[model samples]
Target chain A: MLKSAKMVMERARELAAKRRPVVAIAGAEDDDVLRAVSEAVRAGIVGATLVGQEVRIHALLEELGEDRNSFEIVNAENPKAVIALSVELCSSGRAQILMKGKVSTPDLMKAVLSPRAGLKVGKLLSHCAVLEATGYHKLLSITDGGVLSNPDFNDKLAIVENAVHVSRVIGVAEPKVGLLGVMNEPDPDFPSTIEAAAVARSCYVKGMTKYIEGPLTMGTIFRQMPEGATWKSDVVGDADILVAHSIEEANIAVKALINLRGAIFMGVITGAKVPLSLVSRADPPENKLASLALAAVISGASK
Target chain B: MTFQELQTRAQHIRPARMDVVGATPFEISIIEKWEKRGWKVRYREGELEHCLQAAVDAAACGETDLLFCSGADNLKLIRFLDRAVSRDYKPLTMLQGFEVPSYPKVLWVGFTPMARYDSIPDAIKGVSVVAKSMAELGEPEARIALLSCVELISPGVHSTIWEATLAHMSQRGQFGKARVDGPLAFDLAVSPQAVSNKGFKSEIHGQADVVIPPDLNSFCTLTDEIHLTGPHTAVGIVVGGPCPIALPPHRDERHMTLSLQVASLLV
Candidate 1:
């Protein structure tokens, strides 16, 4: 069972009390970025590395009652340089995990995957978001919002496998995975719909992913799923995760939850040797804090 | 006509050489019997295990010539089988019961449609009824849901038949064996008494194994009518697995014993 976001953050604070989380905040420039950094440092979740403009960071830290002397500030001149230094800090064991600040997600992601500057182990890198639905019983997850668009069936398999790993980390032994689509069963004329159903069936048959449903519509998901029970495929209602058909769909769905469904989303990248936290500007304050804490837990989990 | 011709002419078609994989007591019994007759058989009995791989291995080793399992496992096996078949692995068959195997001509009933019938709890209830009744009679059966005059969509009465069918299937110790087809229009399914009264040689007249009426009311009326109006007999056994989960017939103490005997050969 995945702890609530608040619980995860609290756990991180407890862990940090014993030993500080050495988080390297790359490209720390935005106000939201400063607020998160201040909160993390205040909570002791990060024994901080404030990369990017040093003067502005110190000014912001002083205002938050955080002392500049308590943490190190690296004055990297540009976004690329900051990313390079951040990766170097992580690779060299100076930082336990890399936390994205004001930098664009793709730019930091590129640095992380780059041969010289990033952490790339040569498997698929995917985005997995841990979501807490208001009415649902447990934390659910959805994937590929931060990376990969229009993945073929094999890619979807890898995504599911990757997501399953995150579920295990989040503490679900056999998470019920519902493959999202327009309908549960395919209309033969719609090739994509048919392909989606085929993929769901394939995963079920391969015994690769636990419970799976496909081509499922929203009607069944929000309205019709039997309350308080788990359903496999054909509209697994209020799924732990909403796997999208493409990044476009994923982005739309995630945004909808944030904008419409009122959900708290924490994003991470799996399928790497080390789990990475990739935050966004639009993310609520709680989600940003949760993402960093999750990173710390997953990073220290191995060590 | 030969058996093959008769089989082909039948509206419903099923894949032969059914491979019974997965181990429940039922499947194990099914394999035991088929192997005893010297028919090649392969089985894997474990959690989320692959009988297809074993089946393929058996095929390669010349130990078995056919493979069988409930079509529920089709998607799971299809990809591997597709790869195996593409690599010249011998093509295996998908066994379907009470269906034409192809779409348009066949409609699969039972719990298989639960995914599509989420909104309709009544449909599920109907299946439960069928499963329970059949269980009382002793059968290893999948709950069969009946559709209405509508050809493909499952109606509420399906749950009724399904519960009875499932009971029968389980009692007989088989999983996918009970042949439950239904809601077939009276003209096509049963005596065609209504249609013949209007004069015609019906496609499925007098040959229907199960007839689904429009609603619960119609369903009860028809069952009573069939028994009262004609000399009719029903002997249903769950077929997909080893033991026939069946309700022991009132007249035959031998039926259950015979079912167990056949089940013994399966393992």
Candidate 2:
């Protein structure tokens, strides 16, 4: 299994050497956006298609000392048009990954989730941020952090499936999915715990993902359950993926590790026809590269 | 403060009477140990619900200064206590204290998902009650961070709206004497470096004494996740009710005992 973000980046660098994928960045006029894209392009990790203000993008590239000829820049001053064109690039198979740049999450999501975008694969689109935090033995994936505000039972299942897909892409063959809830016991009053229990039962029947546990807390996941406990999930303390109940939960958690523990993270939106990288403007350049690399690897492996 | 420090802090006050609703022999021994240390311990046995009610009733009647229990369903105990004590779920804050190795000082947190509320305003009121409870705990001027996924207020995310509102209210001295701010991501709330990196100007300079998680479920998830990545000693106590209700931890026996000890101070 891929243990660290470093390993994933190395694998992506190698894959890019073999066959570089294309990334289409919507609203790609921001310096941070262009910087990361240019770095990826220069490193041969991926080809780029920038969609935004053409003149400003050229100037920013020049100021950043990058050649404008390197990328295919689309001139669209309107934010909606910029988003549509970028999504269109991926939908048309001209690009392998759709990257967010200088766009609010809601704005980008609105465009991608629109029926005209044709990105959804007949299911939900959820965000998965693969993190390798210090003190952790292996990489852990947090899901639905960037998208899917308040997921329902079915939405959560779909979110888990999407995370499982991402987990497998990054080399967790049998991903242990831990559905995060307040307590292990499913109380009727607390619908989240009950949903977690129901999701675990459903996953067992589906048999798509291995080792699904829920209503599991962070502490319990890492602790050993006593013998013959009525509620024991093996995913405790060794979960490869955390299916958060809400987007804010996952987002806050992922960012917590990123900010506090200096956890290296690569975020991607799944359940779409093409993989998506929603790099934050505040994300350091290295993390941006890693997110791009993750997208490259996912799209490359799928191909 | 750390659990050890918490035990010592309890020593500042005189030992108080405690009511144990349900316990095994091992738990009884711990209670006995406390009794020897000048605590007046009362033991009760019966059905879990009945014992819990009796314990609550006794505390309600000023019969016990401290309350601790084991064997009752955690939610059941919390709900029963909230209804029996808090009256309307203003906020029965589960104050968790963590002594993280990587952290400088012990962190205090309130995760209030114990009771249902009518609306967002009701939820914010419940959460603010937790902040008020924490305000009385350790830091007189508690730096309370209303944790959210992002700092920006977006209509799409309900938590952000709640956090922004609470932060605004906090500026107006609404959430007690605690210095409160929010719409802060976890890192920004606790990591000064992140705050600098993001150039987010705020009151919580990565040193929030209390982090009020957006929801109770996330608090459970984050608390356990923190344990996994970095095992830390923690003690949880229920506050802002009629009396301090210490829910027995699902962790090891040490935490359960420490949680009880921590509850002693709340009395």
Candidate 3:
């Protein structure tokens, strides 16, 4: 359970202490990425390899009053080539993780999915954003907000499985996954929604997962159980993960929870051989740092 | 229900329009009833199969005043219903419970396969008992309602699973006021003769409004049987989600159209 952001950060620090995961920073065109890299390095959470222009990275590092010699700088062309070279680094075991810098998601994904320099294991690529809420006791993770616009039942399974892996790495032994829907049963006409709930429940029954419940709205999962009835679920009152039906719902829900509910959010891409950090452009410095920290943990546990 | 009488009854509500899909014979008659009342009704077969696309179209085009869905695979169409209700300003509301004026006592009989209510929240159950019991005794129009929780049988020795689940839910206060009874067989539930044959004596023996079927299969089968053979018309609306979807009478195309149209009002 993610009791606090510091708890997960401490866990990441511990994971890094054993053996640091080498992360290659792609599209090193902004100071935010360099600042985050520095934070991760100082915490002993990650070993950074700057893949874009070496001069810019050093200049930023100097401005931040850090020892530039401590970080490994790799001179490369533009953002696109940097992503390609970063993917090359990941493929050759030079780096176990890839962190997006100033490059767009499409450019980063192109290199990650490319045949030559990418790392692919026949699994679909999806994004998982983990949130540490102040109002709640544990860290909550949501998926497919940054990728997979509208995933079907099969795709949802992959998303669930991906989030579950992150949960385990971060110390949630058996994560309770709630398939987000407003109602409990699927409408006969809307097959995709019902299919998603069915798949998650099936996985739970087959012992592939620990907990799965749906036709759940955000209000229901977060709401306290009624006072006098007689029913209980594993995720009642305390949910570790919230699986939305679509990226639209997920994106709105995530932003609302963060901006309105004052939740701390971080993101990582799974289903690939190595984890990839997909930080949003609008994300503040703290969010970027948290994403890098999570990438570090994923890099360590995934091995 | 005759077409004219049902139509007259519908006119009382003065529905804005009607829509139907995968409707049964009875549902079709309901739509015809509404049409006779001068309400526009739209009917389409195999609607559940393409419910998502149809819902998108309905929302985008604004063809009908209200869109109701009635047909096979009601559960499959839940997402579309959710979309239709939420795509606009006035969001649909999914209700968790039904309001019955005549029945003072409600018996929640749980079928072994359905595990949705393992725990009934004490507050809810207490509220139900307190609210209905007091209303029945005090109010001239109020009807006495007794709420009980029961379980239906399952395939194997996961036999006691429902009992345990219900007990847990009750202990945790998941549902409202209702006496929970179960692991009761299907025959004992529907027929008073069967109840006597089993030497059981309970108030809910022959008079139960809502029977919580064990699983989706039992729920579907029992609901269909009630709709097809039972004299009273059956109408179900989905609640307890992001919004409410007014489901048409199952299997009746005409009424299905009307139900979708009714759902459009909430949407």
DockQ: which candidate is best?
Answer: 2
Cα distance off (Å), candidate 3, residue A255? 1.1
TM-score of each: 0.49, 0.87, 0.53
Candidate topping lDDT: 2
Worst 10 residues of 3 chain A by lDDT: A252-261
DockQ of each: 0.01, 0.47, 0.02
Give residue B17's lDDT in candidate 2 (0 to 100): 88
State model 2's lDDT. Answer: 0.79
Query: B-chain TM-score, every candidate?
Result: 0.31, 0.90, 0.46
Q: What's the iRMSD of model 2?
A: 2.2
Query: How do the candidates rank by TM-score, highest first?
Result: 2, 3, 1
In model 3, the Cα lDDT at residue A200 comes to 74
In terms of TM-score, the best-performing candidate is 2
| Candidate 3 local lDDT, A1-303, one digit each (tens) | 556677778878888888888888887656767777887788788888888888777788888888887788888877767877888889999999888887777778877887776586635788888988655678888876667754767787778888888888788888888776644456654453477578777768766467787655455577655345356777756678878765544654554345333568888898778899866544566777788888888888777
Note the Cα lDDT for every prediction shown.
0.52, 0.79, 0.58
- Candidate 3: where is the Cα deviation over 4 Å? A189-192, A225-232, B1-267
**Comparing candidate 1 with candidate 2, which one achieves the higher DockQ?**
2
Q: Compute the interface RMSD for candidate 3.
A: 22.6
- Chain A, candidate 3, TM-score of 0.91
